[model samples]
Target: MQLLYACVNVCVFLGGLAEEVDEKVLHAAFIPFGDITDIQIPLDYETEKHRGFAFIEFELAEVND
Candidate 1:
């Protein structure tokens, strides 16, 4: 019997980011590394601003290197 395996990519976390940073900024900064699947920056409802961190998902796991 043969088995197949599927690799899963992991999301990269960036902390200490400026509140002014947004999805666009993150994209521009990370796009050069590889194709980005998604970018998420959690925000505070009260201030309606980023929570000083962001998550970046690259299309390939190699980009993490």
Candidate 2:
């Protein structure tokens, strides 16, 4: 599972998310690894809602590992 933590940028895909997931929740989850550069949660255009996936970018590249 450490391999999953080793990336400056990672795209997290959630499975069967019961509710809408926001950027704050994702940021908190990744903060332990390193500084967060940015977080993007793609939402549906028609419904204007989260798509159950997010992209997290860390400040340092080495933090990915």
Candidate 3:
């Protein structure tokens, strides 16, 4: 995860989310912060369920504090 973070300019870890949350919802929630380069919501391959958290990548390294 650190490698992925390093490769990206700016990133954030959003947690304590409900199980129903998906990538699009996460993206919408973070737009006010800055330009979103990527949004990842890991899924359970066996259960086909969202893991209840997300990783958001921003366009620049200074997008977040």
Worst 10 residues of 2 by lDDT: 1-10
lDDT of 2 by residue, 1-65 (tens): 33323344554444444345687777777799887777767667898887666667767465454
For candidate 1, write residues 1-65 as lDDT tens digits. 75222224657888999767889999999999988887878778899887888788878655353
Please give the CA lDDT of all the candidate structures: 0.78, 0.65, 0.77
Best candidate, lDDT-wise? 1
lDDT, candidate 1, at 42: 76
Please write out the lDDT profile of model 3 over residues 22-50, one tens digit for every residue.
88888787899989888877777888987
Q: Quote model 3's TM-score.
A: 0.75
Off by over 4 Å in 3: 1-7, 61-65
Best by TM-score: 3
lDDT of 3: 0.77
Per-candidate TM-score against the hidden true structure: 0.74, 0.63, 0.75
Where is model 1 more than 4 Å wrong at Cα?
Answer: 1-8, 61-65
Enumerate clash totals for all models, in the order shown: 0, 4, 0
